[model samples]
Target: MNMEDLTWGQFKALLLAHPNLHLQFKYAEDALVDASYHITEIKKAPITSVDCGGVINNWTEIIIQLWEPQGKMGGDAMKVEKALSIINLVEKALTLDAEANVKIEFGNSTFYTRQMYPSAIAVHGNDLIVDLRPDVTRCKAINRGGSCVTADKGEECCTPVKPKVQLIDLAQTNCCEPGSGCC
Candidate 1:
């Protein structure tokens, strides 16, 4: 199933139902998280803000942070059942918004720290694969409306204009030169 189709709570419920399945994270086709990484923390962040154009926006996110043990022997990756247990423990302490967006935060010596969303989730054999996708900055005002200035149709708003520049050769004409109007 598409990860984008499922809410954070729905995804957690799915993981809980598949107790025997193993979990694997894929940042890209060739790059994958270490097999020893574990889910260290789950955070609920409620963000409210105004965009560059003064449009107010609000959203919530469930941030799942993953970490690999330091200097440890080879360890098996976290199992789906174990992950469910961790979620259950977290749910008891803090209420999680089921409709909130889900994001996974991960980093290592080779990979820079980033919070990415799951682009896709698939069940292959005994493993449940989560393909993480990076997020990009976007023009929120233009997205929410037609233009940053107004939502009216056929109206041009905030069109970029090239700055006018004048260039003069100092060698041919200078302020210090004769009859150059220097004090």
Candidate 2:
């Protein structure tokens, strides 16, 4: 993970520091979420998978989905306290991992729905803005000195190679047989 990766604990700490400020989200350059946005849901996903390096990986993520009311156009963003209250409510039903990775799920008329990582968090005037960036894909094998790609598409990195066995002269040795006492 990069320095831009935000954890659940860090996010909560940020909100606690500026409880009076309005919370806003910025997905792209100069692009911000509608002021009427709402924190609809908080999801905790536990993921387990095998990577390209044949390594087993496990991790968790906390995804917060934002939705803008279509009828409500221009309004002030919700306060950090309100958002934190929602999180507190969610915690009552589920145990959240503070160290889990954090993601923001959002979409608009022009943008498709996607889970984004928090690239930056800054205080601007009376608002606290969270800058989000699209999540990227990388090969774990390449990071572990194994090739991410193979000459043959059917081949994968770190695939186990089968061992070869040699034939022995069974008749010359006291090998077990169907009706023999050694069997």
Candidate 3:
């Protein structure tokens, strides 16, 4: 609800404080971005239905559309799954929001976690209440101690770059249950 720097710990606190909040997402990319992903060509996304889904009373759905993939991107096959995974990951942030020690720095501009709800969902037009909020996190390389530890309290394995994300979380966050941070 607040737009300011937040440590992972602070973010955890907020989500833990209010675990019932839901999340939604919308992705708008230019024709160029789409074309690049497919490695082919997309004249334009006349009315692109990017990805959609989230907790509707508890279940979340996710879908993605790209121009096309010519070769076998075995990883590409999991595109939809990845989207959902992102949702799940973020929900962890929320459920563990109370336990997160958030810290972020974007090139010279030091910052903290901030909760951002899409403007599209802000409208109380329909009889719909916003169920999710997109959260912002500082990428690992850009922030302090943003490295990935595949196993906690154990030896560090692969350290990956922090994701520059535009992620959404549902109240139950689809992948997370009440009081469970999707861990």
Predicted model with the maximum TM-score? 2
User: Whose lDDT is higher: candidate 2's or candidate 3's?
Assistant: 2
lDDT of each: 0.79, 0.86, 0.30
Q: Which residues of candidate 3, in runs, are more than 4 Å off?
A: 25-183
| Rank list by TM-score | 2, 1, 3
Q: Which digits, one per residue and each the tens of the lDDT, describe model 3 over residues 1-183? A: 342334334433343443333321222221111112321111111222321111122211221222333342332122323334443565555343322222211111121223332223232222112222344543332232454333334433334337686555656476555665554
Which is superior by TM-score, 1 or 3?
1
| Residue 62 in model 3: lDDT | 20
Weakest lDDT window of 10 consecutive positions for candidate 1? 152-161
Query: Mind giving the per-residue lDDT tens digits that candidate 2 earns over 1-183?
Result: 363567899889989999999999998888899989999999999999898655788899999999977875766799999999999999999999999999999998888989999988899999999999999887776775556654455576656666786666778766676664444
Give the residue spans of candidate 2 off by over 4 A.
Answer: 1-3, 145-183
Query: Ranking under lDDT, best-scoring first?
Result: 2, 1, 3
TM-score, model 3 to reference: 0.18
